[model samples]
Target chain A: MVRIRNLRKSYGSYQALRGLTMEIPRGELFGFVGPNGAGKTTTMKIIAGLMRADSGEVVVADRMLSGKTGQIREMVGYVPDFFGVYDDLKVQEYLEFFASLYGMDGKEARRRTAELLEMLGMTQLRDEMVDGMSRGMKQKLCVARALVNTPELLILDEPASGMEPRYRRQLKELLQELCAEGMTILISSHNLNELAEMCTSIGVISKGRMVMQGDVPTLLRRQRETNPYVLQCLSFPEEAIQILKSDPHVKNIASSGTNISFPYDGTEEEAAELLTALVAKGAQIVSFYREEGSLEKMFLDMTTVP
Target chain B: MRHLNPVYKIGLKQSARTKKTVVLLLVYNLLLSGLGLVVFYLTFDRAGRVREDVAYSGILTLYSVMAAMEFVMILFIVPASTAGAVAGEREKQTLDILLSTKITPFHIVTGKLAASISMVILLVISSMPVLSVVFCIGGVTVSALFVFLLLLVVTAVYIGSFGIFFSVCCRKTTGATVCAYLAMIIVVILLPGLLFFFECLEAFGSVGYIGIRNVMNTISGKRTLFLLFNPVISFVSMLRDQVGRGISIMNSIGSEGGLFYFLSRHWFAASMVSQLVVSAIMIALSAHRLNPTRKGWKSGRSG
Candidate 1:
């Protein structure tokens, strides 16, 4: 639903986005991960039609974002990392206001506002002033505001920032539900695990470049080839370490107390065989399991400059 | 009719709903009533008797004061209303969200400006009943009142445009407001002062009673060419002309030869048109400043 090609943006001498390129298909929940100043927000802003790139192309929902802002804006819902709402407006009025901004008539805007409020669980506070609501409630309102236009693509920059775990989970579930309903979402956040649990695909950026990006499982699998294995021993941990060191598949080993972990580049059958050999060599193996590759580990591995 | 611009609609709703607006309107009316009472009291003779001509003159003075006060209030209030319109959005961090929508920068600028102008118009309309006190005594006509209202709106547009332009140019509301007020001061006070000094030099250079007449004529004449740019001067001249004054100082200067004469003849119209033109340019510039794709305009990344 969104495609960016060689997008480059500079702030004087510092390049914020340097030749960055990525594509997200329709109905995909894409997680954009990057460290501080890694240009995730910049890319999202460019796609939202709130910013201009020095050079490159951004196509959202089949429309070019450069000069076709009105068309692209109609197709995209944007939630900035930091946003503010009209304090004096009630929750319902706020939503209705934004809906009207998208040219929805009063009747349609009211209907959509009611639906969004109910969907976002804000119906109870429909008449409440926005200024008095908590930050989490306000964040939910912003998300609802973005969806007021029923945009096909949602570009959220750190939507879960500064939220309690419960609200974060609610947002995660909401996004997943939206994706299930055929809305494409490109979200950026520091919470890798949340993204891992919800995103259909992930992109890792560093130093203004897309270091790695793909389907979550594919990224994890790619990391798993050089994945480490941790062997927790009831006894004979030293012997287990020695055995692991001598093994052809073991590239490196580190031991602390009863646990020994090492990087293993071997097939599952070979892994089982190696475990059997360690057990046969008088190494008490209470638990022997390959470390499960996670999005956080993959992100760090891909983005950390060696 | 087309649907109202959403920004303008929301802005008006929010402004109307605010308690501050209600309080301001009440206080404004009270102040006008107080001024009217004072004018009423001063119109009577020392023995507490009211003379017909004096009462008529008092009503005329009251109308002049009301119009001038309304203009001054609009000048003061419009900048405050609009100087923070865009800058407040930026400060609240809501500008990006607004920019992300289908609305163009022109829509945003015009909507904001229209909202401010609407408030000024509201103030002017609400004061009409107080101004109608003049009609009771027979000094002001409906057409004259209509012209005064039009002049007030045009002046509000002129001042409010400056406020919005500065709001778009400045990152903070406080800075924009200061700049707007400063610009108003220059246009309303400093510029006229400088022009008067130059006119004085011309008046003093010539000799005899003609020189003195030239001085009086200069004050009544070519000086208006410069004063035409000042809304205060234009407003005062309009009021003076409406009150049975034949051939205003501006018109007298227009009776002389040269380009100043042409400018003098059309001084009021030229001033109104020129203010509108300048306001239009400022509004366009503000819209341009808000546009992200415009060349040399800073994008969200840099911001």
Candidate 2:
């Protein structure tokens, strides 16, 4: 779990994070979506303790981050957007080297390296030089490197940037598996649709501010509340109007010829009953539906300038 | 060394694997071999013509030249190898990943310096054949080789610490390398230049260079402390103790009963101890600079 409060960071005259506040609960596959220069990476760096926030209180894995990086570094794993490989090290040696950095014993490091290489499907490439690997392969290795410590919180900044489509899907599945295994993952990316398909919860940030955040279904349902249930009758309009006007769940009802639309504050069961009543009254309903709200649509609605 | 530093492992493995190290080894041995053989032929050429003791003492000259040459080579190589230690990590974008691990800042600095020191030690050890040209003939003791080897390692560490310190301070490898060399230049060339200027000041308001050593005897003892920072002066002072005054370049040699005389008597120990302490301090400062979350250490200028 991570809790960031009013995190502020500045690069010269540019304010990277200004009063940015967010939280990722335990076992959360939290997606951090924001436009470029929207403080996503800055906030991730602050949480990972790779950077110092100018003025803010950040609590990571229940430890209060107060200028001490070592205390939190052990609990948080970080994978940067862009990273280079050691030119001389083999893939297995590279992973083992990082495992050793976390103070793992030689045998433990070797076992962990083997396990990670297997998980990454890099067992065949373990002996290959890391520098000669493809960009996508290198990115996957970095992800495995971040996990070598078995950290509780994994902060990934644009992890899928260089990954191919197939690897990106595998990465999503792997992240979901990790989250299911009780690891909290905070992944930031520019792709809302990709995140929507995998993330349990999502947050939209803009101008160093968290504009919106909620669970996927709840956020989508909240957006859906703005749309009205419409009913268009090809015939028998008077009977449908009479049944709708008598309904207590419908408000702001408007009927013109056979077309009717109104806000409905009722459960699905109650709506079903109302529709039956309309049929019983000889109402011929041609179209009766509300449009579904998507995460991308909501992200654009929140982020795009009016 | 219960837990060997991971950085040290990688640093050593990568540098040793490079063709540069092998080439350097070949070049170093060849150069020292060339110098040694030249001295060898010249000494044997005077074998029958010169006295027996005089011919043997020529071996001492060979020893001093090899040791001095190794020291200078270390001076150039250590900085070039280590100036990019941390800055190169930054350029490669691996510094943050390494810093984010359980390894402390001091650990990284020590690992880097240790790796470089090990490489320089390898070079020194491999040059033993060329140096055996002197010891094989006789005159220079094995104890003297041990002492010189120790001196060489200490000087490498001292110079390597400045390079790593500059690596931590500067963002660019070029900037860090330049600063490291400049720091060495100050300690090697300028520090002794200051001592020479002090001798000149003592010789001022007098006629000519009237018995420079005699005048140096009257100078303050504190002036000789500056020579402690100059590894070359301490090395010559050290070599003089091992051999005799034939090779000493120390200007304050005859300052009787003064601080200069006291320090000059123990110049090798004083310089090594002083430099080790300074190296420790530079390493500590570098470790401090390498840390990202340390408050009040960062320049507010960046952001």
Candidate 3:
């Protein structure tokens, strides 16, 4: 769990973070979304205790993280967007080095390294030089290094950047599995679809500020007053459209041959009654479904300048 | 006892793994052996036509030359070893990841400095056989050789710390290396030169005033204090002491009644202590520079 209050940071005349405040609860998979130079990385660094804020309060796991670095470091595992691996180090040595930095004993570090290498599917390449590996493999090793300490909170900054889709999907599933195991994760990325699929909650930042943040479904529902519904019929498409147009809640009707789509502002009971009404009208309906709003649309709607 | 520093361990392992280190050691050994053979041939060639005392003196001279050369080698090699330490981490984008760990900044700086100094120590120890030629010729004692080795290690640590300080302060490795060398030049050459210039001004009147003979005597008497932290002067003084000078060059500079006179009288100890103090200060400053949450410290750009 992380809580930030009115965090403000400036690099000379440039303001990187301004009055940014947000909170994530325990076991929540939070997605941090922002455009370029929006202070997403800045906030992540501040939480990771790798940077100092001009003025703010950051509390992670109920401990004040500003001046107390030892506890914060123990709790947070940070994966930077771009990081270099030691050229001469094998994958195993790299993980062992980081684990030892955290004061893990050699035996414990070896055990944890083995477990992490296996979990990240890097067991085959344990003895391989990190420098010779592909970028995706290197990134996975970086993530594994972070997890070596078994941190309760994982702070990843654009971790999926420059990765092939396969690696990205693997990372996504890995994060989802970790979140399921009660690890709180705060991930920042430009990939909206991936975040939309994996995140339990989302926060959108713009211009050094938090513009909007909430549960995913709540955010989507708030972005649109009425849910869009599509109805597909084998026959009587015109009669179906007419029947839907007559409904009080149905609006914005558009007909494309056998398919009719419209916006419906109604509860589930009303929607079910409408479906029954269409069935009773001798309309051979093939499919009737509500179209869920995409996170990309919500993100653009929230982030685009007025 | 506190569990070998992870950074130090990693640095040592990486340095040993590289072929560059092996090749460098090989080249270093070749150079020392060549220089040793040339000195031996020249010394014996002259001794064959001269008295027995001349042969003894030649061996002493050989000892002094090898010791001075080792000091100079450390001077050139330590900065190159350490100038790229923190700067390389920043350039390779591994600094943030390292900092994000629980290791303190002091640990990182000390680990880097220790790693660099250890390499220099390894080179010095490997050259011991070449230095033992003086022992075989009966001019240098084993204790003197050990003392010289200790001095070399201390100098390496001092210069290495200086380089690491610049590395932490500069964003680029080239800048750090240049600044480190410039600082070394100032310490080795400019400091002594300025001291001599001041003594000259005291001895021969500057402007319209006649020279104050008494003040000139006092200033000249304490002139050796200026070389207290100079590695070359310290090396030469110790070499002179080992080669039957009966007294260190430091005590012969002059005699007066002050702290400067005491430091000059015990120049070897003063030099070691002063160099260590300077090294500690530089290492502390470097640690401060790398600390992210420290006030007035700038944050490096992160990905």
Candidate 4:
């Protein structure tokens, strides 16, 4: 749904992006993760045609992202980290204004505005001033505005930034639902935990470069040797920790009272065998399982300087 | 080809919410009408007050007030209306979101510029009664008032476009507003002062005041062309034509059958052509300003 190659954006002496290349498939929810000054927002802006790239090419829905900005704009829906709402305009009016800008006529604009407002659960507040809305509500309204044209590619930059926990969850669910509906979504976010939960694929960027990009499960599996496992014991937990720490396959181990978690360099089966060995040695084991790796770990691992 | 009614709706609502703006417009209209009525009452018992000298002063005051009001309105309203147009969107971080829509940059520019001047147009329309009262009391014709109003609208649109253009270019609203005002002062006031000052410098030469006279003659001749860029000056010329003199003012001031005389005889066409050209340029400049990829120092590198 989107392709970017050798995209570089610089402001005076500072380079915001450096030959970043990425592709997102149709109906996929791609999470863009990076630390501060990682060129995430800059990449999104270039793809959305809000800023010019110093060099390189971006293609959205098979249309070049240069002179075809109007076409690209039609195909992409963007939600920025912070969005302004006109103080005097009502929620419906704001949506309608965008609809008209999209070339929809009066009747059609009104119809789409109503539909999107209802979809975003803003129908009840249609008459309310947009400025009077809560941060979450405004965020949702921005999402509604983005979807007013039913864009094929949604480029949302930190859409859930100021959203409360509940709304964040709702936004995640909504994104998942949209992806299921065959809408491709490219999202850049600081909240790795949430992105990991919902994104089908993820891209990690550092210093204006894409360090790693792949499906979440595949990324986790490739780095599975770094996965930590917890072994809960009913007795002799100290001995269990000492044994696990001494094991050649084990890298690091930590004990929390009866619960012990440590990195396992060996296969899952071998790790299970180690747990069995502990039990055979008169260590009563309650449960032994691998700890799930979150996108947070993957982000830190990718972005942290060597 | 899209129907801009939705933009129109939002624009109207946005302007209506500004109570301060509405009150200010109301005060302007009341003052204009009050001043016109006062003149009418004062001149009621006088004989031959409508003659050249008396009419010149009364109408000069009226025309001056009208031109000044339009200038002040454009000065205050354009910046207040358009200072935030694009910069504020960026500051609020909504510009990216807005640009991501199917709306082209041109559409966004037009919609924003339209929204800015929507209230100014409404206030101009609402001032019609007072404007007509000026005509009712004075010797000015209805066509003159209509033409003046048209001039005001054109000036407002041109000024509003500049404001939007600057707002789109600058990252800060304060900077955009200040620059727009400064540009206005240069075009309307400072440019003329510089021209006259040069003429005075030349007057001290061997040619004496003859150089000054020639310069003044040139200005009087090309008054319409000069005033075309400065709407306030054009408005002043329009008022001067309506109240004091006609094509003869050019001859009395200096040269005969020059640009001012030609414009005085064809004020409508001259004003239309000049305003249309200026408005188009302003609109084009504003559209160019909205281009995200346009060549500029601040243009970010894309990687």
Can you tell me which runs of candidate 2 are displaced by over 4 Å? A227-289, B46-54, B206-219, B246-260, B296-303
Assign candidate 2 its CAPRI class.
Answer: acceptable
Model 3 chain A: lowest-lDDT 10 consecutive positions? A235-244
Top DockQ hit: 1
Alpha-carbon shift of residue B88 in model 4 (angstroms): 4.0
B157: Cα error in model 2, Å: 0.5
lDDT of 3 by residue, B15-65 (tens): 999888888788887888788878877788656666443455688777877
What is the TM-score (0 to 1) of candidate 3? 0.90
Candidate rank order under DockQ: 1, 3, 4, 2
Give model 4's docking category. medium
Candidate 1 Cα outliers beyond 4 Å, as residue runs? A237-243, B45-55, B206-213, B216-226, B245-249, B256-266, B299-303
CA error at residue B240 for candidate 4, angstroms: 4.5
**TM-scores, chain A, per candidate:** 0.96, 0.83, 0.85, 0.91
Candidate 3 retains true contacts at a fraction of: 0.61
Give a tens-digit lDDT track for model 4, residues A64-108: 877558878877788766776676688888888888878888789
Tens-digit per-residue lDDT, A2-43, candidate 1 = 888999989888899899999999999999999888999888
- Of candidates 4 and 2, the better by DockQ: 4
Residue B4 displacement in candidate 4 (angstroms)? 2.3
Measured by TM-score, how close is model 4 to the native structure? 0.87
lDDT of 2 by residue, A175-243 (tens): 999999999999988787899889999999988899999998898888887667878777765766777
Better of 1 and 3 by DockQ: 1
